[model samples]
Target: MQVDPGDPVEVNIWEAYIRTAVTHAEQDVSLVELERAAFYERCRNAYAVVATGESALYANLIIRKGVVAAG
Candidate 1:
């Protein structure tokens, strides 16, 4: 499951990664499915930003914002 950032992202490999995450999400089945679809959509429009001199493995990072309350 070691993926180097420089390598091209393959469809099957990406799908496998998504499946693995969904499996261990510990969320309700309905919510998992909803989020899974969102993930797939994000993948469909995904783009890679390759940086020069970046040799670190799995250097990609994802940050999601927490829910904000509407006052």
Candidate 2:
């Protein structure tokens, strides 16, 4: 399930993917861990907010808009 850098993905489809991943995960894992794994798989770096730290469990999921060229 490798996605191209600029591939257009529908919101619903992405949601489903995440849900399925969590549901079928080998062991119980937090949403944060699941998302971070996804970022790593895509070869992308993720920075945690200092304020949130590890306390922010089940936090808001970050969505990448990708690179958009200025017209």
lDDT of 1 by residue, 12-39 (tens): 4445546666796555322122244455
After superposing candidate 1 on the true structure, give the runs of residues whose Cα lies further than 4 Å from its correct spot.
Answer: 1-10, 28-71
TM-score between model 1 and native: 0.26
Q: Residue-pair clashes per candidate, as listed?
A: 0, 0
**lDDT for each candidate structure:** 0.45, 0.47
Per-residue lDDT value at 63 in model 2: 43
Question: Candidate 1 overall Cα lDDT vs. reference?
Answer: 0.45
- In order, what is each prediction's RMSD in angstroms? 10.2, 14.8
Query: Per-residue CA lDDT of candidate 2, range 1-71, in tens?
Result: 23434657433444564787678766553433244456556444544423344332233355433456699
Error of 1 at 26 (Å): 1.7
